[model samples]
Target: MKILTNLFSVIASILLSASIAAAALDPVSINLRSDEKNPASPVMGDHLQFWSTITNTGTSPIEGLVAWISLVEIDPGNEQPVDLEDWSAHKAVTGASLKPGETLRTDWPMRLIKGGDYRVVVSVTDRGGRQVYTGPTIQFHVRQKPVLQAGRVLPVAAGIPLLFIGLIIFNNTRRRHGNGRL
Candidate 1:
């Protein structure tokens, strides 16, 4: 009975120490935002810029941190596991140590390849692989460009030549009827 009690006490102490260590490492906060005003719907073939901000909120400085941005496609109807390797772009490594209360901002620029539903995920991890902070997922849709129809194109193309012809006729008539100076 005494041995059992000692074993339970040791387990509790280890769990408590782990919780304290995790609390001490909770010093970094990450936020992600896009430069596009309407990130929910971006036009296909347009360049999109995403910004990630890493702030050290604790008193101790953090070292050897790395940041990355990933793009994942979502199926609106079914449950599918997001494959991180699907389409990922942009990775930045903080070469210098981050001071307490300091912020580091990184930009990831990617061109829209096709029209579909997608999400961007941004994350920051410490060098020791003990701490990881991930920002909220940004859900967005890429829309195809509007098609130009003949109903819209024909009128503009025909109107310009008719205006030029009318202008030429008016100019010739004015020259013939009025004096050269007038």
Candidate 2:
């Protein structure tokens, strides 16, 4: 009975410690907004405007904060964004310190020219160079590019088949030469 009690106590202590560590990793609060009220579609070469407000929930001060947003294609499979010049952008703040119970908000703006849903993650670090908090991944969607879809003489999806054909042709040639059957 004593051994069982000790085991239970150890397990409880371990769980509590795990929770505390995880909580410390990123204790942050975030609120994001956009100018457009309704969900609009995004095409190729479109600029997306966004705003973010980040708050520090930890006891330490935040030295800097960084935010990243990505757009992934929804159709067929969740594909990655194309022609993205800057998938990750950070606010320019040097020696910026945030005391406990303090919050920093920025009018963050970024351009989006991809088709699909996107996930965004924002992280803030402390003056001690420790990651204080990481915000949850935010998701958004983009509209398909109408011009590319219409003007495509060959389907982008066909590239897979073309690649496979090339591989097969190369393999056959190599095998034939290697086996003296060429």
Candidate 3:
């Protein structure tokens, strides 16, 4: 019984070490960034683009990797994950192979539909979905677009002033001609 227990312990330790070594040998590295490092108050209806760079740092060629971008709204009292189906058309990119030291860059174009504080991240996953690599988070805020009602009130506001000015001028002319009532 003692020998059997020791054997089991040895096997478990070996398996654990191998899994750790396999993780350490993963070759993929990813980085994500946007044109604006930290967008200074992007507004609703704004367009923002992000780039994800995937590199193989190990001595082996990596294959069957998929990368995608994620956006999340982090506004106070209104935090939620964003649905990118309509916001971005180029959400994911797949690489067939990445040779050692080779890099693949993917672009993500997004349109802001809602105003809120947000964060963006890029994630890379293997074909089998066993490994997931995430890049740094980019934070930003989108302000609500300003609404102007000048189109509805401009004519009235301008017309009233112009009419008053015309009346004043007509009254002055009448007074000069011996009719002083305004």
Candidate 4:
């Protein structure tokens, strides 16, 4: 009986240790940003850039990790997510591994075909199917190019000559007063 008790105790301890080790390997963290470095309010037919960072906060290194960015139209009525495979100019970076406490960044560039509200999402997954991370969704708006109208263009066109004339008159007055020449 004494030997059996000791054997059971050893097995239980080993199982507990293995469970702790498994629990330590948690999912990584993901952060997504939309043109945060140099923000631009894009319009239709404009190219938009996205960035994402995957950080390994767990105790173990992750291998065969894949990261991707997705875009969806949210406003002006919801639409299905855009298929990146269909986009000829879309590009994304993928990584193979991320060590503990290490960070990897990926960039995605896409062109705006329609102008409306949209959202960008970033996600990362590991090969072992043990970890998955998803970053927060970023919302943005793409506006259509403003229509050119005579009412808006004529004032600016008229103002340019007026400004030039004012500058010339001011210069002439200054010259005449300071040097006694007109």
Best by lDDT: 3
Which of the numbered candidates is closest to the native, going by highest TM-score? 3
Considering TM-score, where higher is better, how would the candidates rank from best to worst?
3, 4, 1, 2
Whole-model Cα lDDT of every candidate shown, in order:
0.77, 0.62, 0.84, 0.77
- lDDT tens per residue, model 3, 1-182: 99999999999999999987976676777788887653566888878988888888779767788888999989888888899988888888875678899999888898888888889999887675587888889888889986668887899999999999999999988788875443
lDDT score for residue 178 of model 3: 77
> What is the lDDT for 123 in model 3?
85
Residue-level lDDT for 141 in candidate 4: 84
Lowest summed lDDT across 10 adjacent residues in model 4 is found at 86-95
Would you list the clashing residue pairs of candidate 3? none
Candidate 2 structure, TM-score to reference = 0.52
Q: Assess the local accuracy of residue 151 in candidate 2 as a C-alpha lDDT between 0 and 100.
A: 48
Pick out the ten consecutive residues of candidate 2 with the lowest summed lDDT: 83-92
* Candidate closer to the true structure by lDDT (higher is better), 1 or 2: 1
The local distance difference test score of model 3 is 0.84
Q: Model 4, stretches more than 4 Å misplaced? A: 1-26, 36-39, 86-92, 145-182
For model 4, state the Cα shift of residue 176 in Å: 73
Give a tens-digit lDDT track for model 2, residues 1-182. 99999999999999999988977655577666665843476654576565666776778766555444333444457455433356425443345567677877765555665556776544555456654355565566767667645347466578879999999999999998999954
